[model samples]
Target: MDIVLASKRRRFVWSVAAAITAVAAGDVLFYQRGAYGGQTGFALAALLLLAIACRPAIWRDRRAWVAAAAAFAFALQMVRDPGPLPWTLYWVAAGMTVLLPATGTFDDGWRWFQRLLAHALRSVVAPVLDLVRWRRVRRARSQWRFNLSDGLRGVALPIIGSGVILLLFVAANPVLAQWVDRLAGPGLWELDAVRIMIWIVLLVAAWSLLHPRPIQPIMGTFDGSGELPLPGVTVASVRRSLIAFNLLFAVQNGLDIAYLSGSVPMPAGITLADYAHRGAYPLIATALLAALFVLVTLRPGSHTAAIPAIRRLVGLWIGQNLILVASSMLRTIDYVEAYSLTGLRLAALAWMALVGCGLVFILWRLRGGRSASWLINANLAAAGLVVSSFALTDSAAFVASWNARHAADVGGRGAALDLCYLRMLGDSSLPALIELEQRPDIAPALRDRVRYVRNAVLFTLDRRMHDGGWTWHGERRLAAARAEFPDLPARLPMPAGDRMCDGRLKPPPAPPAPESSPLTVAARP
Candidate 1:
């Protein structure tokens, strides 16, 4: 019993130590430096810190290794483009982060994710409880104990030595220096409440990662199959619905094919742009509803699923829905080409593709007799994959550049340039606007408008840098723009009132001339 007590006490001490170490590592990677501050090298370094502090046996677990790989993927994506999607996936995959000590035993990803969430909620008060437990552990007498001398020599000395070594390494290595900007966030004596609060948050997050545990409420299962649950969804009714859904979808696809190929003339009032624009989003909605209908009616374990005839019909319907999704995406593309690409349109394209992937997964589930959990996981994984790809892309910059190339003002034959819209896109649009302003073919009037809007954007960006505190991506973009700018003007006052970045499709009417008076006599040019 004494040995067992000693073992428990020792483990608790290690857990506490590990939590502290994790917190320190988090401070290095995240803290106040901003998202992806350390980038890839620092991210890996932070992971290494967690590995050393976490239980040694976790290293032997395949799940733990898989979790580490996921961490790397998320961190790299953050490095590529720091945004909410990568951050969401980072925490989503973090369910298995280092095979968290108190995540309890789990066989699958879904359970791990559920446990992580349960544990995280409980961990809100974990710090206070852990402190209370520490008091109890301190009073309990044990034969095997860690004394002050032992702690000083064994723990503190090593930490002090390692910190020194780390500092030296950081000085010698640029990557390390970039990753470990120790004490560089705020001044050593600075009292920033926000930064301090961020530190506390990081500590809680790290500690929770190490010692997560809570009642993992009974997870709901996807075994919700059977005719009993979905009333009136009989095999015969399902057959009729599948055939009808397929026919309706076919009609949509057929019309799309005609418009897409220019093989048929419009019936009447619909212009190609209007036809493309109107159908893009609504068709996507139709596909989603069709998917939900399939899930509810065609349970793999149901009587309908047992029949090969029903399966073929359902398969045919899903195939048509996939085609419909493709048509929707093409419609969005056609609309964009006719008008101009915007951030929202780019997102619409990605969202449509994700919907198509969901339809495919639903069909696969029916064919394979996969469980509800399996289907959900497959769709989630697809979404995560798409989101990560998006995180790596610069949608705003892409839209700006695409519009710049295709705008008829500069020589291309697409849509007329809308500098107002480009200005609305913010700093990311600066380079593209600079390109337009420099073009000789660009109208003199348009060039002057671009210069005015461009100068205002530069002023805002420059002011942000001057305001200080480790601005990175923004600063780099501003520098690049400055290098490209022709005879860069001094920082200008930002536009006030409703300028619309100097008007929409066409320039606004020139302000009315003031009446000439003795004191307001017109001056000769």
Candidate 2:
């Protein structure tokens, strides 16, 4: 009975400590005054929240410790990149890490999915359960009088002690001081609907981790075998489909090799860019459909997969699909060369690559006679890896830098520098804009235009740095820009309308039509 009471006391103490840490850290790291945020603050808050939320597993299980560390590192990657991709990767990695003990293993994608749903359910249910537990505790302790003064008296030691320890730690580590400075940068008292929403979300996410349950996954990994009761798909149907698909894909590949080769003349009125760009995304969709058909019809252990001839046909079809994917990638690249790359185009390129990888995994699964679980896990792992890789690199900054370098303004032969688009990219384009503004090759008139855009971006970044949603990378860039160009404006330019931000007075002139000649084409790359 004494032991049970001690255990309850420990649980209550830990819960209080974790809750206090979460609230204080969240306010310091995640509170945004205005519209923009979720870069640096999110990176820090995610890790801190993971620690506090997963504290139970973290202390008891080695696997949990490893998962927490991995999540922390993954989330920390956003410090450098800080875009939508990183944000997604961080949440996925963090969520899975928090739920790892409950799921038992990471090998089954279906089980993880089941656990994800449970995680959401727990986010809503756990807090109510906690309140019930607290009520019971309060009833048990009712004999001892408690009030607001008693609560203040109880917390004083912890508050003063923690402050002293934190000061010493900061003194020992200069980096901690930097973190504190950044955390203290935003307003401390701001509150609104959005911030309240953020608070609710943070609380729910944290509490879900704190009160985890070992859920028996309801959905098991499905192996797409003949015995699974799939209907209407037969060996004969798959064989015929493969034959027709092979023939159709062959025709498409043939046209790509001939017309896209630049060695052979394209049809009248169809230019290289038109042919290349037109089929870029559509071909990817076609490949996806072909991949789905192969997965659904020629599933491993199915009669369609047993025959060597059909397997060969499937292999041939998959190879053709890969070629189609490659052609689509080439087409997108060619379009990028002719036009320019944007964040969306870059993501499209990544998506195409992911499609190609998925097709390869599908073919591998069939060849190995692997289960549906294997195929699903392999594809998901491939996708997660691709997203993680992209997350580690700042795609927006890369796009901005690439566009600026290749823009026709500095004589790189690509599209003219679109100041409007650059402005839309926000502070990610600030460094590139700064570089373009200082380039010796820029025309005097173009230099003035670049200066205006650069100033506008600089001003906005300053507001973010002071207000909220700023990154360490952004801070470094701002510092470097100040050192390089003292004349860079921190105030909004007096010029309004077209010259305000990106300064688009009129639409940019349409680019000239592409030549039909293969020699001028960049399709090969």
Q: Give RMSD to native, each candidate.
A: 8.7, 12.2
Kindly list the per-residue Cα lDDT of model 2 for residues 141-237, writing each as its tens digit: 6554543357789999999999999989978998997887687653544678867877676676666655555566887877675533457666677
Error of 2 at 9 (Å): 5.1
Q: Which stretches of candidate 2 lie over 4 Å from their true place?
A: 1-9, 28-56, 59-62, 78-84, 133-202, 227-232, 489-501, 504-525
Worst 10 residues of 2 by lDDT: 32-41
The lDDT for every candidate, in the order shown, is 0.71, 0.74
Give each model's clash number: 0, 1
Query: Which 10-residue window of candidate 1 scores lowest in summed lDDT?
Result: 32-41
Model 1 stretches with alpha carbons more than 4 Å out:
1-48, 76-81, 100-113, 137-196, 214-217, 224-229, 411-415, 466-472, 485-525
